[model samples]
Target: MRRTLTAALSIAMVVALSGCTLVSTLAAGDTPTDTPTPEITGSGDSTTDPSPPDDGGSDVDGSGDDGAGDGPPAIPSDVPLALGEAGEIEGRGGNPVGTFQVDGVTTGFDDCVEPEEGLSYVQVDLTITAEDDLAAEEGSLDYATSFALFLLYVKGPNGEYLGDWLGHECVPSSEWIDDVGPGESATGSVWMSVQTPVDEGLIEWRYGHQNFVVPFP
Candidate 1:
């Protein structure tokens, strides 16, 4: 009986140890799993940014933002050319008499003479060419004589007559061209002083009943 009791006690102790080991294994298996870490590529501020606005800036052709065409208006091919333009005028016998161009315009007085009160001297650089055919018919270009016959009429921007020619007193005499033969050209300066300064106006070259209006600079 003593032996049997001892053996029973030993068996109970072994069972208790085995149960403890099984409990430990089950507890370890039931533990909550750890979550995986996300992959980080770049630095801070990972949120996606918004796109930029489209301002109507200059175009590839260098036009304005308004998309208007290129530079100044196209000059008409008529007899009276615009400022800094050249054209020919038909004279007697239905032939082109001469080609004229207003090269430039100058204002203010030099050391030689002063302009009248409320007036300023405006000098127009004129270039006139007479081809061989016209020069043969009307003789050579005599500026001192024929220039007055051109009947140059100056008008303000509002079509008001500026005044008569101020004469060649202002410009140097050496700059004057008295004549030009066939196949030749003459360049001279014409001066005028108006009571009101001419900002933009028309210089009409009138002869007989025909007139050609040229714009001022």
Candidate 2:
């Protein structure tokens, strides 16, 4: 009876160990997953999808985002070029009150000059007229009062284009007019000294997209 009970207990222990080994092998081979598990995080699960890129290859307006196409792009009109008009001086125009003709001619600007042997320089002359309401209202702001002329140029008469000369040079700036009154004419000259090979036509004049000699009007 003792030998038979011992044999029965040994059989039971073997069966229990075999069952545990089968369970571990199955768990290693077959994992439970309702969603994809990539190495990276933030990826969408089974139900959601990733977003599309901004620019579609063909540039067609309605390619991806929805049936509604992109709105029409803005188109700008060409304004007539006036005789002396610089078109716009930025910052100074658009004042509420004034007969402002940002229009003006650069009479002449000298090639790099030297007042003294050690002092080499260049100067630009311009004539501007502001009649009507703008002239009257210009006095209210002290900083907004001056008419600025920027001179764009090239180097050594042969080098690539160097930009505007008003503030780009070494010499002190010359102010033509600080403030103009109503029904009055404003005239002035500004000058600067820069280091470069000096020659005529080296400094190119620009008014909007147009390029030419000074004193256009």
Candidate 2 segments whose C-alpha is farther than 4 A from its true place? 1-46, 51-116, 131-145, 149-184, 202-217
Which consecutive 10 residues in model 2 have the weakest lDDT in total?
Answer: 71-80
User: 130, model 1: CA deviation in Å?
Assistant: 0.6
TM-score, one value per model: 0.52, 0.33
Model 2 C-alpha lDDT per residue in residues 77-124, reported as the tens digit of each score:
223334344333222333432222323333234443334333334444
Error of 1 at 163 (Å): 2.3
Quote the RMSD, in angstroms, for model 1: 16.5
* Maximum-lDDT candidate: 1
